[model samples]
Target: MDKVYDHRKYEQKIYSLWEKNGAFTPKVDKSKNPFTIIMPPPNANDPLHVGHAREVATQDILIRYHRMKGNSTLWLPGSDHAGIETQYVFEKKLREKGKSRSDYDRDTLYNMIWDYVKDNTGVMEKQLRQLGASCDWSRFKFTLDEKIIKIVYKTFKKLYYDGLIYRGERIVNYCPLCGTSFSQLEVNYIEKEDELYYLDYETLTIATTRPETIFADVAIAVNPKDNKYKKLVGKAAKIPLINREVPIITDRLVDLNFGTGALKVTPGHDPVDFEIGEKHIPSIISVIDMEGKMINTPEKYISMKASVAREEVVKDLEEKGYIKKRERLHHSVGVCYKHKTPIEPIVSKQWFIKVKPLAEISKAALKKGEVKIVAKKYDKIAHHWLNNLKDWNISRQIVWGIRIPAWRCDKCLEWTITDGVVPKNCVSCGHEKLIQDPDTFDTWFSSGQWPYATLLAQSRISNFQFPISKNDKAKFEDFDYFYPTSVMNPAYDILPFWVIRMIMLGLYATTRVPFKIVLLHGLVRDRFGVKISKSKGNVINPIEMINKYGADSLRMASIWGSLVENDSSLSEDNIRGQRNFANKIWNAARFIFLESVAKRGGYSKAPTTKNSYDLKIIKQLRVTTKKVTRLLEKYRLNEAAETLYDFFWNQFANDYLEKTKSRRKDAQKILDFVLQESLKLLHPFMPFVTEAIWQESKNRFNNTTLISSSWPK
Candidate 1:
């Protein structure tokens, strides 16, 4: 044994040995129950940050623990072709080379991005291996794989035929820069200070934040309960600067206290007004184009950006004596999550899924305990989202995702949906000249079916294959065994974006919950509780941490610092402390091995009952073992790690080892027993160091590897 512990010398070699020995492959034992977790696929376009590192560490702990407990454990790994994010990254690269996506056709750009993501996916997998994640590499799946795409298509076709999907011209949250519409979950709300414009029209007043949208106003809405606007409900008011008359209507959706008790109903520009206007108004007008430029407005504001048009319209209104009053107020504004640009509400034709029925089933599954959420506090959050769920928009105007498998006939103007192949002729009109839908399915539309698609694609069932037409049924044996996986673990930020949708779609497609347990982890933030991001200049690279400190040290630091349901802050000092703990482990093992060899001939045999020191240490180990097993069973990981740390460092090293130094043979036997059991408990969190120590003393334990060894009784 060396006098000093150096992690760099052993980490890579030990990791390679474990992989070569197939330590990560699940044992196919039908007698034991199965445990499965589908890794939340990271975006393949970027390197992983600290958040990804935390998930890897936390999930690896669960997998290793289950593997040792005699379960058929499988952790499937994958990556996502993140639609908007990947396109944004490639666009920047194109600009550097004096080219753009517009320079080529759709096929050319899609193929280019596919190659780009393939290279990045390789890099990310290497990083995961360096982090010591024991996922099943043989069962790895990608979202864009041909077999997975077939499953996604099958789900879409099923939804469409079942009357759950439809195309309609409705108001959508559109990002002009990305040229795509986003679901409500994808928009970020930020507080902004803006001028509230109160415009005077004849004898009535209308309040609005966006005077630029006045040209599209179809009516004026006021609360029906407000007595102040009762007499003017049937009257007409002229729009400022446009000289257009629109009816004054009564609707309950209006907030009576906000700015002048009257709202300009611009159905084409606002979500709340869109619903009210669709029921009460006769026509809808659009004054903004898809580029977010003022389209049907007056000459001065035409072709101007929405923000610029707002400034010019406000100036003109003030000069024309139409401004009743103005006040500065802080209000919520929706922005694109990808580009941070202000979102524009535009009415466009897009595909949508009726999620109300699906959410009902998901909610009932939670209530019935078929799907259990850890940290019971999150039950309310999951219920709240499910109860208030709206229709999901599942279409995007991007070329990098799975194209919507619908075709439109030019001769009869009818639509035909083919499950996985392009139809030779339209089913509705028998027209050979048909154009496939230009839009693509939203990225989440494919990802929501991840659990079923990934498992079914890799299944051994020969009956389930790709290019499945609408007439063919899709079923697989792997899904029958692993459909309701053991757990679904992800960070809390995605509870709405990814987790909830997974439940809803998983149930709709498979008629079963995706997982039995929903384990929600919090974000990995900086020391001050601020989220780590590249734009904030606070990003921490996990690879650098693994290079500096060993993978085991980084993994231990992550577990020690985090609670299962609470955010954890990262700092250099934390990693340093964990590194020191790793050193303590190595030194403790060294002392035990040298003492056993020198004092008791070779390895110490099991000791008989002898001294108070030996009995006390054995009793404490039993108690620590029980506590750790209970904590891990309840998913209280940090508490378990902390309990082990204190017991080994304070109880075993400081007290027992010191007092028993006089009885060399008895001390050696007790030390061997304690160290062997301790290695088992710590193997899940610190695999490399514990395994290295266990292998060095191979003659001590019948030459069984610590990884495949059973947990302490």
Candidate 2:
């Protein structure tokens, strides 16, 4: 052993050896239980950030540990062609070159985005390898892969035929800059200052921040509990500049205390108003178009931008005595999460999934304890979201994703939903001149089916890029064995956005829970506890840390910072501390080499010895092994890692090695036994350094690799 552990030299070499020997791939033993984790496929748009590193470290620990436990373990990997995000990123790149997506047609734009994402996906995969991820690259998948799209299409057609999918003109969160509509979950609400204008309706006074939407107001609503507006509820209120006499209505959802207790029911702009309008109002008007410009109004306000038209409308209201008073208000406004622009609520005919039924199935499974949640704190939260589940918008006006497999006939204008390809003719009208819908499915809609789809895709595809240990085992039934994966590990922040959807869709499509365990991790933050983001300039490039301190040190540091249901902080200082731990481990290996004790006995069990130092280390290793193994089994990884660190640094190196320094060979059997077992316990947490130490002792131990070694009993 070298005096110092050179991580850079040994890390790649060991990883390549593991790959060459097919240690990463699982064996097809029907006797052994299968343990699988379908990796939360990261976006294919940009290089991974620190958050990605944290995710990889957490999953890898679980994967490698399970593999050693003699389970048929699999960590399947994939990439996401993140629908709206990728298109938005591509457009930004186009702008850098003084071009726009509009400069290219749909096919040309899609092709360009595909090439860009392909290049980035390759770069991201290399980064995953650098982090020592042991996922099966042979079965790697992409969201846009023809195999994946087929599964997505299958689900879509199934839901459509089952009456769970429908097309309706409903209010959706539309981003003008992105030229796409986002689901309600995709909007980010921000608190900002705006002017609230109290308008003089003939019958009642109404206050609103958006005077530009007066043209679209079909009714004025007053809370039924508010006695002040009881008489005006049945009367009509005249609009300000539009001079339209819309009926005043009573609604339970109208707030009695919010600004004069009279609400403008512009169903075209508000989700609550849209729900109320569906019950009372017969006509819906959209004054603002999808381009963020005023339309369907008088000529003067028609072409003006919505923001510019707001000023014009306010001026007109004041000139005509329609404005009663103006006051400054600080309120929450929903905006597009990606572009940070106010999300325009517009009525668009889009595809939707009736998710409440699916949510019910998932909720029942949760209540039955079919799926276990880590930390147990998110149980009530998961139920809360499941209870409030609503219809999901599944359409995105983009060209970069799996386009909706539906066609509209030029004759009957009815849709013909098919399975991922254009039909010969419209099923509704038999029209040969049918046009396919130009929209694509929302990214989450496809990703919701990730666990089942990926496994099914793998089972169906015969060829593999890097076939793992073909001679060891032929390909067996993967989907039947791994359809319901062992664990679904994702960040807690996306628990509602992504995880909940996965459960709902999984149950609806497969009639089974996607995974038995929901092991929720948290965000990777900076030392000051802020989220590591490129926009905040706090992103610690994971590759830089791996280059500085080895990937082993980086992985250990990541596990150190993370706690259950809490954001983790990774600092350079922490990584350096872990590097010191690696050095401590290396120094112990060097000390053993210098002693020249050639008898490296692979003790299956601890030896009973009269020497107190030998007996004490053996007992400590047993207790530490049992405790650490239990913690990891329960998904308490941080506690398990802490236990490992304490046993190795404090008990083994500090006490036993120091106490037995005078007569090393006298305790060689016990010393080698404890050291080898400890290496097995720590290999899952820090693979490279521990495996390097084990490989050094391979000659004496009959050439057994630590990775393929069994867990300490």
Candidate 3:
């Protein structure tokens, strides 16, 4: 053994050995039960943040643990094209080069982003390897893989034929920065401070945060139950800036306490107002264009952005004495999750999925406990999301994802949908020249099908389709072993967006649960409890930490104190302490090997029961072994990690090895036996250093490699 521990030398060499020996690959053994996990695919084009590192650690712990338990374990690795998010990143790069997507045709831009995603995928896979992830690289998939796309297309075709998909001109959450539309799940609410403008109308005062939308207002809405505005409901109110007279309508959806008793109704601007106006107003007007600039208004503010036009319209209203008063207020504003820009609700033609049926089916399965969430608290959250499910907007107006396999007829304006090919002509008419919808499925649409797609792709079954009508699960070779994967481990924040959709889509496609368990890990936040992001300049780079403190320390520190489905704070002190533990492990191994192999001329055989010190530590080892195994089975990695750390440091190193140093031969045997078994127990959480120590002290291990060794008995 070396005199001092230095991890920079051993981590890369140990990982290379594992990879070269195909240690990560699983066999198709029917004798052994399969334990599989599909890695939650990360965005390919964006640099992987610390959050990715945390997930890799959590997933790897389970994969390695199951492998030592003699199961056919497979951790399928992948990357997502991340439709809108990837295009947003690529477009920012294009903008820096003074080019945009409009500068090229659809094929040209798609191919360009393909290259970008490919290059970044390579970089990301390398990072995952450096972080000691044990996912099978041979099974690595890209969400845009040809076979995966076929599955996505097939699912869409079946949904369309089943009357679950629709095309309509409804209000969509639009992101001007990304030049795309987002699903409601992709938008988050933030409390924003803004001014509330009270406008003076003839009969009543209307309060609005967006006076620029006055040009689009078709009515003023009041709570039908409010007596103060009962008479005003039948009258007409003039819009302040546009001076257009819109009718006053009463509806119960209006909040009477928000601003005034009445609110401005811009059907094309707000989703709630759109619903209300659809009932009372005769027409809908759109003044803000998709680019978030004023349009269909007076020439003075026609080209101004929404923010600039708001100031101009407010100034005009104040000068005309139509403003009653102003006050500051905080309200929830819908913003894009990726671009961080305020979402503009605009009426646009897009594709949607009726999720109610799927949600109900999935909820029934959850009620039966067919699929269990690790933390019981998340069960209510999952059930609530399922109960209140809305139609999923599955289409994105971007070029970086699987384009919808549907076409629109130029003559009849009807859609012709297919599985994986362009229709010869419009299904409704004999038009030979049909144009495909220039849109892509939302990234989640493809990702929701990941587990089955990746598993089925390994087989030659060409007849696989959705709405499975048979009981045979052996049609696909890999699916037979890996279907109903052991667990779906992902961050809790994506529970609704990804996990729920996976359950719904998986059941619809394969007629089986995607995974038996859903284990959600917490977010890795900064010390101040803020999310770690590059925009905040507080990003903790995992590779840098690996280079400094080593991979085992980083992995141990990430999973040590994290609770399931909660956010955890990242601390440099925690990582430093874990590094000290790694050194302690290394030094203890050195002392045992020196005494047993070199000084005592290779001591062997178990210590006799006359030595109670040895017996006491052995009994404690059995208890620790039982406790750690139980904890790992329960998806409690944090508690398991703490158990190993306490047993190895406090019980074995500090107490047992110290108190029995005077009994030469008996102490050496007990020391060698306990140290070897402890390394096996700790190998899952801190693989690199423990494996390195196992290799250097080869006489201690019965197996050639620590990773392939059995759990401590």
Best by TM-score: 2
lDDT of 3: 0.86
Query: Clashes per prediction?
Result: 0, 0, 0
Tell me the RMSD of model 2 versus the true structure: 3.5
TM-score of 1: 0.96
Q: Tens digit of lDDT per residue, candidate 3, span 1-713?
A: 88887988898899998988788999999999999999999877666667887788889989999999999999999888888777878888999999988999999999999998888777888889888999999988889888889889999999999999999778899988778888888898999999999888767888889888888988888888889887676779887656678889889899978888788888898899989987888478898887999899999999899999999999998999999999998989999887778999998888999999999999999989999998988888999999987789999988989999998888898889998788889888879878899899998999999988899887766576676545546677688788889899888889999999999999988889999999988889888889887778887888888888988888888876767567878877778899999999999888877764543322233445668888999899889999999999988888999999999999999988889778857677778778877888899999999899888975456666788888765
Candidate 1, clashing residue pairs?
none
Candidate numbers, best TM-score first, in rank order: 2, 1, 3
- Give candidate 1 regions above 4 Å deviation: 460-475, 596-607
Expressed as tens digits, the lDDT of each residue in 1-713 for candidate 2 is 77789999898899899999888888667899999999999997678877788789889999999898889999999999999888888899999999998899999999999999887788889899999999998889999999888888888988898899999999999999999998878889999999999999888899999999999999999889999888787899999887889998999999888899999999898899999899999578999998999998888998899999999988888999998898999999999998898999999999999988988889999989888787768878899888887799999999999999898999999889877767888888788888888999999999999998888787655333211234412453676677689988888888888999999888887678889999888888889988877688887888999999999888888878457456788899999999999999888876766655555547677766898778778889889999998899887788899999999999999988887788787876777777778888998889999888988864544246788888999
| lDDT tens digits by residue: candidate 1, 1-713 | 77776778877877788878888877555678888999999998778888888888888888888888888888999999988889988988999999988898999999999989987788899889888898999889988988888788888988888899999889999998888999988899999998988899775998788999999999998899999989998999999898889999999899988998888999999999999998998478888898899898889888999999999999999999999899998999999997888999999999999999999999999999999999777888989888887789999998888989998998998888867788889788798998989788888889988987898888544343233333333345456566679988899888888888899988888778889998898888888879888889987788888888888878877767568788988866777788888888888888777764533222223457767788899899989989998888888888999999999899998888778667766677778888888888998888888888887784675335778777776
Go through the candidates in order and give each one's C-alpha lDDT: 0.85, 0.86, 0.86
Considering only N, C-alpha and C atoms within 3 Å, which residue pairs clash in candidate 2?
Answer: none
